[model samples]
Target chain A: MSHRARSPSTALRPTRRALLAGLGAGAASAFGLARLARADAPPPSGTAVLLCFFPGGWDQLLLLDPRDPSRFTASEAARTRIDPRYDELVGLGYRPELVRPRAAPAMVLGPLAERPGAAVQLTDFAGRMAVVRGVDMRSVSHEVATRYFLTTEFPRGSLAQGSSVSTTLTALARPARPVAHLSLGVESYNDRHPSRWSALRVTSADDLLATLCPAGAVDPVLADALDAYAREARADVYNRRGLVDRLQGARAVARGLDRDDVSRPFRALVDDGPENDALRARFGISRGDFDGPRARAAMAALALTSGLSQVVIASVAPAMDTHFVGNAGHARLLGEGLDAFVALLDALRTTAHPEGGSHLDHTTVLAFSEFARTPLYNTYGGRDHHSAGSCLLLGRGVRGGVVAGATSDVGMVAVPWDLTRGGASPSGTVLTPAHVAATVAAAAGLDPTAFDAPPISQVLV
Target chain B: MGRAPRRLDAGQLRASLLHATGATWTGDRRVRTNNDPSGYALRPATDLVRHYASALGEPDYGATTEPDLDPGPGFLRRAQSAAQGACRDGLRRDREVPAGARRLLRAVSDGDTYARAPEAVRANIVALGRTFWIRNLSPDGPEVEALLGVFRAVTEREGALPADGWFAVCVALATDPQFLLY
Candidate 1:
């Protein structure tokens, strides 16, 4: 009932040779067939996941998918029907230009990528990043699009239709941690997985501590009595549909939480200690910014490095629903989020993993928004929802500095892409959320069939 | 074949506790003192029902129309926390009044230890089982003896007083599947 690994000693251990061979085969051919070819082998272990979500639709032209200013100018806007008014963004003090960082020339990013910041920028990690452009979200509504991207399955109206990718990864992971999956200020859904893999959702570090820490410790006698009664009652219950069993299992988890003192590290979120100061400074989080993107990023770092969670999903951006005048500060909001994301990557890059490499070497980071904004600005001087979206996949098992998929030049519609060749093709498939989910699953050595879409072979290492 | 039983949602659980014991679990707002001058603020004392509503499978109706019917580990642990807090409140209220006027511990007093008064202990256990579970438990039945085992362990081995033992019994009965499920 606990879902704890029964024979951890006999669990499948991933070697460097197996990982390279698996990823090589996956990248060379369709992951569906490749996974079937190796069906007898277990998924590679020691791979962690960090799923970063930026709320509200991000403007594709301003970030992941950029248009050359010289080609799509104001005069050509009428013919192309796409206009990125870079001159209007006065916050950057200059008309932002598309940047291809010298280190990662194949990765084209928007102006915000090169923004000056106290923390690192997206350009810092471009060598380890892969940009998936022109992804079709299939929905225009915020709730529907968010869930669609989160679970890689379209929602039944506003309700999620599948288990979250994080939950899936956590369930498949062997030698589980105390809290296998942790979600901070992000929605996580679990449909059919074991209840133990359900994400421990919290808004902040303080909230996590409060949830894990006992309100008031009862006398030891009372504690012993309650635990004993629970055990006796557990045996008596018929466990219809495993409800009582899950309840009893959760009581054990509660006890483990106290026994392991899992809340001790989270206490540094508010406590004034050397490690707390170092984390705040490293993540570029000020004293009062506890629940912002930077703080969430710092929490993700601690969760991963401290071995508290195997998969962490955090909302690294404030709401960027910039419809009217709010659009003026859209770049600033996105810049802050991107800065926090890079800081998280830097933290992982510097921290050591238990498996003899940096945490970044063993972790895969997927950054996405619900959808992208329209190519053309709306009548309200801001951009509206657009069906075409883009996402970034970085860290382990991902081919770095590569761009896959593309939108059209005129309407910014997603064009059919050659998954194996990494370009546009008239007969190829259009990129969708399912493809991205499959790619993530495959990179983590999970079965791509779980996502019902073939992994994009060109994006894998 | 028996039809599967449905677990109570957070709202129904709260209402049931209030209806049965005339008490609800309410978490107090305690100020968090930290060395950081900027992170210091007066923490708001929100009620536990609202705080644990999401974990208790209560639907907001915006994203989900129906409550999460499957009770998982998170839901069960939160339910236990709620029961622990609510039963403590019930015991506190019972302790403030005379034995005749008590709502939960009417069959026994705070001073009635298992060694001193075993009949009163069995009576209190039966009364609690009937109050929370609506089942007429035999005082000498295995069910009563199992709960008595808990009381005996607490009072004898743990060296806890009768009031603490009663609180443990109250929590066990309230959080049991018989009380949680309809």
Candidate 2:
């Protein structure tokens, strides 16, 4: 196989027709032309991406990368530095055993996946899900590891060095969405991509409403004057940095938010009217629980279904950085996050897409944490941050029911894995977040080479 | 080579608006919570500014080292939203004072219309131009006429109150790019 490295600017050439079209009457300035020139042709597949970030390091042993409890018992703790201490986990709702779905005999999920309170279980989508284990995160610091995974570029002194994967995919897809990228309770960076592709970051539904809703009632005359004056003033100004045009475009989007009544569906979240009773029941969103994982998942569903955004990065899980008695709640925390992810999957599956099948058929989901916890408990009875991590990729172009990569038996360290053959290999390449990102890019119908890493082709259909 | 123009960040924008208009975008006042020993007597806009800080490209000061000076649509919308509230308060404050003591709507009186008092209305537009953008304009110039055009159009419309023109003028000045950008 051969590949040529190209900058994002020159990777795909803009045809003369595209160039002329992009250079609209209003966008004739050098900066405007340059920005529009970088605009990507829409992806051929019309695939949307949902990047689910599980904040804090999650314990993979309890979920995606569980060890066989019968073999790695406490009695063999000395030989194997790892411990399947599920017995010590308090308030654990399910028995400490591996979940081997009959449909997917090759896949083995941990007991925590079946932990109570989750509306949807991991095993529910067994045939459609794919798990990539033993990813080498390369850093244990929360900030470092998170940015590394998010951008696939290691942070320079905890500072993100590149655009987030959400921004990248949004730039590639360039869907004509009101808010192209919506980020709920997640950090999104756009260092190189156009500012329009930047994440419209909000912590909760109310915050999102505040961002999208028009300002409070003003007299019609005043509103008309403000609108007319703004239009006239903007027309006269030509900002060298294209800020004027961007601002005008932003204003138009704000008007569109009002014109289309985009905030109507989201208002159902805060309003406890009978109209929202069905929505509340659908995502398990309790009254006034507008910022929880379930609520975020519901918002993700609505955002995608309503064509409000092209990519959404939602933190569907709570912080699992349990280094003390907090570990007692580790299973619950991890379970709730996974449950939110499950709910999101269910929501995608049940919701009908504009094209034909369910939204899940066209959406790609990548669920990850900064890293995983240590194999063994610390003195505080909780796990410390571990370098090895795992991720879940499924839906839209992913080869389902596949487990690709493995950690060592003793120390739970990431070992070399054959991307092609799907197991530990002495001479195989070690999986990293870069490879995971590349695979998602590939799954989204983008050239994974743009990420400068090869997609694990074995995981793609 | 000339340096490129950079935008005023959220903090700077908020401060400038406060300094220029003497009113900020106010929201519901903060009340005492169980976690608070002394109830926070913060001004109304304090919480609002913080709430929409990210929307306006204010850096979190920890992870984000510099403000996001992108001037993107999100920032523009939030800024406009904030301006709506602040300009309303500004007009209210202006109306409470006598014409001479007013910060905005200086030359125009409560019942002044361009048809009845065109000179006073044009003078107020000139005053607003100076206050908002530090620009001096002739009363007959296209700039003042443009503002008068807004005023004339508003007051001429049915169901329009005379004060609506001034409120419109207030919003137009405050939200204009000349006032927002440095």
Output the number of the DockQ-best candidate. Answer: 1
Candidates in order: C-alpha RMSD to true structure: 9.2, 11.3
CAPRI grade of model 1:
acceptable
Candidate 2 residue-wise lDDT at A161: 78
Positional deviation of residue A239's Cα in model 2 after best superposition, in angstroms: 5.7
lDDT of 1 by residue, A1-461 (tens): 01122222213322422322222121111211222122222232378899999988888887899888888997998889788777666566534688887778888887777775444667878888899988999988888898888888889978788888887777777435667788887777777777777777766665566666653432444555677777768534446566666566556666555444455555556667665676677777777666778889878876776566778899988777777743347787887888888888887887655456777888988999999988887788788889999999988889889899999999799999998777899989999998998898788777778877899998899
List where candidate 2 sits over 4 angstroms from the true fold.
Answer: A1-45, A75-79, A117-119, A216-249, B1-10, B28-46, B54-70, B114-156, B159-162, B176-182
Span of ten consecutive residues with least summed lDDT in model 1 chain A: A23-32
Cα deviation in Å at residue A116, candidate 1? 2.4
TM-score of each: 0.85, 0.81
Number of the top candidate by lDDT? 1
Clashing pairs in 2: none
Tens digits of lDDT, candidate 2, B31-107: 33445433223345454666667656666554345565766666666677666666667777877877677776688
Candidate achieving the largest TM-score: 1
How do the residues A199-252 of candidate 2 rate in per-residue lDDT, one tens digit apiece? 877767767887776564224344456677777775334376666665665566
